[model samples]
Target: MASLWSKISATLPLNEEQFPLQFSNKVESSVVERLRQSRQQLYSNTTSTSRMLNAQIILDISWEKLNTGTWRDVDKEWRRVYSYGCLFKAAALCRENPSEDELLQAVRTCDMGLLMGAAIMDNILQDIVRILQCEVRKSVKEEDEGEHMQVKRRKTASPHVPSIKDGLAVPRIKCPSLESFNTNYLLPLKPVILEGIIDHWPALNTHPWSIDYLRSVAGCRTVPVEVGSRYTDEDWSQTLLTVNEFIDRYILNKSQISPDGVNDVGYLAQHQLFDQIPELKEDIRIPDYCSLGEGDEDDITVNAWFGPTGTVSPLHQDPQQNFLAQVVGSKYIRLYSPEDTDKLYPHQSQLLHNTSQVEVENPDTEHFPEFIKAPYLECVLQPGDVLFIPVKHWHYVRSLEVSFSVSFWWS
Candidate 1:
């Protein structure tokens, strides 16, 4: 297998742009180059025996040798190999006439290889799972073209709003200078709504960050969208979908709501979409306020939040200060000071200790009596409004309409 891979590698030039998989410096460039060639051939749909064997060799080596690093390192490396085309190769190389169980074994082998490469890897590996699932469906469709398959669709429940009473709202300022914001809000860890700050953004005017424009530009790019009413819900899950599919099913179509039930909400939340599709990034300029931090503009981490109305981000705190810029629609935001963590009934679960268990809109007094004592601030963020949330401030957000928000996180 090794000798065959060497021969194959000798035939192709190392094309870094085509294959962006990066191995650590510990691995020789020659080895990385060979693996890239094998992955390319595997996805090229070449059914030659030698090509399959070479792909198997690449998988085997990656599995055996890629296990010595932090989980983050391991995850990066595994995603690199998996995304580059190893899983597809494993599926195609099952056999000339493979049984269903045999094909399943191919998936299992690929899964086991990812685990072997990174022992601490524990994510559902949604990217690989979606690919294999699609492959299985395609093969089954090929075999049963004459038969009609009935698909069962489950509609996810929409979030129910509890009653609300008035509270002190976060102060709203129109185009406050960077010095005032840094001196008053940043220093005091106060939440404030700054209006007229995003009018200059190309996204607001020239770029047309609307549904038609996004579909035209980034429809085919694969993205991870959260599918559920809220992250705190038991049914919460993540799936990979094309931007077009997300836009059509969740954004453009109102078919999600019917007498039967509300459909599963798909939210493109907290994703580094700017990094994935750079063309979209050109539309928005980093705010001057973000530069008030110690680092330069490049140090800011920008993320996107897009979802239908009623999408809720349950009460939670983030480590970095955040400026959430409302781009397309309105959002109802509530914030609690970090000092009130004890009063908010923080979750007892280790994974969610930073999140408040009490639903802020309507707290069950019997369960979370202390929550009412937590002084809170609220605001309805409109398009062109930017809300600054201090680090560790417990915040909850619910969209008032089909919304698109850009968030910049910085120290």
Candidate 2:
């Protein structure tokens, strides 16, 4: 236990000089004093649960202020407060001879801060969490080697292509030049299937993104998942689960049960997973075509979508240009031009204004009569295919098998 603590401690910043809480310039001196006092209380008695709880209360006060304004307008001091709280809790847990669950909780707390907090604070928690994850993966591998091998064998088998529904097929080009793509696709606002562009991605070759490899690296990390048939359903809700739990219940178990027997669906959709798990991010590369737009490379937003077959993303439109890259499995997609927006019948509510009321696959013709006449282009997105969708173009998607996709959105 002492050796374990030594390893954890070594990963953390050793002193205030290395990890200072210098928010006095950005916030009131009184607020800075409160943060300093709370940090001191944690270090004074690192194993005291009561002290940790008290520090959390102080941080929570700062956190509540963040919700009062738009995210970009919120004071940086508040984000730092939340980040510091996560770091304090992680350090306290490390001193108490923490269990595996405790370590995971600490890592998750830090990850939340990293995702939502300010960048001014030191990322001391990143190193601490990586060390913790490595230890957990070691134990998991020792116990589940046989199961892991079974999954690898199953995943390596060729994926079956399902029949795609009828619609005008989106045009496919074999890696068009930047000038050609901009002239024919980007400027014209036409959606096109790009081939030969993503074949060099490591995800398709040397370090393939297989089930076993994903479970090994991120099995213990916690992530948010959408539970229920699809987001359009009233029952649709979101919850957090470890990567292993999601794979076991949603991906692996689905294979064993009959399609009709399956009740609930879990989808890890539209998540910035790369920012949390840097290891998985290494497997992918952003398309060079993103540079054709006005936005800088840093302005691009990358999101991951992973789920089983039958998962649906109801007809919706996005505000930016999208490059949907399929890494594993396949999907059937339908696209309607912005000119058909009125026919598609968008929701009246401010929250769902971008989503159409009509189900693309099974339309309610009586209520949305115009939707029946809305012409659309469809395609079967296979492995290594990148579908370039113009801004505000209505699109509907459904997975044909257990799938993983990465989408890059830029202005």
Candidate 3:
């Protein structure tokens, strides 16, 4: 749940054998320029870093919301900035003198890591970029850093906590004193999963849209795949192509065939099951959504599955908050908190998780050194059990049995 890191994983050489990111040179070059400039201004303390954080984090960068199928196509963008190594030089700069501008600037340079880390940080401190933009950060002098914190508590001028009528709240708790909590708790952002939130969740499990899609994968309409994963050997191109054809045919195929073996498609397959549970009409958007898809803030898709073992294509903390709901079979999840960012060896600026899947039951930390001491939160999801994975959390899932789940997110 929390960790205070001494060593950062960015020191290691990146394993090129993992996944090739064919980034769009045109789309990413500007992002790199802004990141460079931000870093230049960091040591100078230009106009107060916190005051400039909003512009650096949200306005200066561009984020694209993509489906699982085509996400790899943008790999080149990641490589341009971090081609030589894990390239986390910025991490060191941040630890020495953490500033709002510096952090935002570093994330700008390492866009992929920023996006991946943003997913996790956003859950805990929702509208973080916005907050930084609105609030002015006056650097506290060496002897006064602690004093400012104390003054914040003692003054009548302190800001008040506002209430939300109907919205997800970020976990930014205010405490009376530092002594009241452990130091480790402060390093990592925390997520507050909303319990008993949606009313129709129960009805979805009993009558899932799994039957048709599971049978389709069973029939081999598309091959079983491990997309963009750092686990087993996988063919990214073929897998992506097959998935594209499946969607085009079933959804836009012009041929009205029964939706079969679709559970393998993941949560986005719910786009097809629109007819199964009419009550869910208000909860989701279908074919139309398939075009626009989920937002960049929270990228979500319904992935369908139906193998004896429901294997995930990859181990990643993509640019989204995942809300996975098992529909038919069961699944076992092994996860590491976002604070373990150093251990995962996450690809800087690339569209993939920092960790490689090595079956945690008996991990091979010799290969994944940081994994040895990484802390995690594991959960077993059954039909109807919705698991919320905050962004940047390293996770691996094994299909307990043939399984299918619907997942969607809006950040």
Candidate 4:
């Protein structure tokens, strides 16, 4: 048991030697009691609707940021969050015949540990599922077996490939006056794929950013890279690597395939690479549409997203309106309106608050049944294509090939 906890702790973004997995009863009894009462109110001979209301009540407790800069920080903040999850799980086990509250409290207190951030793993999510125990979640998967099978078969589709679509086309344009773009799309929060807008950018013609070009330009620069199948995966980890080294291992090396027969992807996603490597800024131009914002051009933040084929940015929303420009290769993008937040089952964690818990490509219906009702718009962004994504819109992205994309974010 000790070894297993050690291994799990090692995977998390924390120093296990300093923050070892340990439990305390005296510290967490009160918090555990509150969680137990909340759980009992939810499951106690109540109608499903009533249970849902109580669950929402529990979730609605105001979550204030905790100061995690000292050893006292973990005890003051992280321990309570960890205990909250455990007690909620133990309460589920007493559903048939309610057990003594004190006995359950003792067990939950002994089982607690610290997780500094708001993120929780699949193992913890399973415990949360037991706590909420929503009825609709059970039927979600069985109801969509055919769709799941389709996603499984499509997983191996060639890189640069677009996912199967329902034939709805995203409006595309060659060029548009600033006035026209603002009125037709920007003001309405609608997405469009702009073409001629990026043709003049030096990235497309003046300089081809091949692997060699990237190495010569910013080879030694260190940047954060995400390693795993996707950010939503439990095994995902972020590491800093030089641009040259990242390209060599994840891109140039052929033996770095996963046991599942897919490439183990490393994505340099949403990084301010242009700022880090200023010379690289000369390669691209921001569109005139961003000028509609109140601030000057400097207010617009530029992010570089580079990755191998099969890399995915899971369903998530950004704070600013985004213009994602495809510089090198293609990408498959899906967008959902903010109105579908309820259906998307957003993660109940502060750090991941902007991210949806459901997997867009192959969502687990039993766990996120509401997702079945969320309508979405999708497009395949080809080289030089710029996609306008409104602020707070849920979007998912998958690289179709060895792709390099630059996104401009503005108010």
RMSD of 2: 3.5
On TM-score, the leading prediction is: 2
Please report, as a residue range, the 10-residue window in candidate 3 with the lowest summed lDDT.
1-10
RMSD of each: 9.3, 3.5, 24.3, 19.3
**205-263: candidate 1 lDDT, tens digit per residue:** 98867765675455545577899877877888988676767876776554344332235
Q: What is the C-alpha lDDT profile of model 3 across 1-411, one tens digit per residue?
A: 011012222222234232232335564555555545444443344554442553334332333322223656644443233321112233333444445555444323333332222222112122222222222123213433453344334211111112332333322223213332223222232332222333244335333444333222221122224332224343322231233244333222222111221232222232323222123333333212122223542243444443333344334564555556555666766666776667766645443445455446555678777767776655556664556565566667665544555565434
Per-residue CA lDDT of model 4 for 180-246, tens digit only, reads 8999999999988988898988788888776656754555445678888777777888886767668
In model 2, what lDDT does residue 102 have? 72
Per-residue lDDT value at 75 in model 3: 47
- Candidate 2: TM-score? 0.87
lDDT string for model 2 (1-411, tens) is: 446667866765566546577765766677677667666764464446765775576567767877777888888778877777777766666667678777777767767666666644446666767877876776567777888767655542233344555558999999899999999999999999999999998889988987777888888777889998668788889888888889988887665333432258898875568877888888889999999889798999999999987778889999999999999989989999999899999999998999999877778899999998988898999999999989999999888788999999998
Locate the minimum summed-lDDT window of 10 residues in model 4: 108-117
17: Cα error in model 1, Å: 15
Model 2 lDDT-worst window of ten: 254-263
lDDT of each: 0.68, 0.80, 0.39, 0.64
How many steric overlaps does candidate 1 have?
0
Assess every candidate by TM-score.
Answer: 0.69, 0.87, 0.38, 0.60
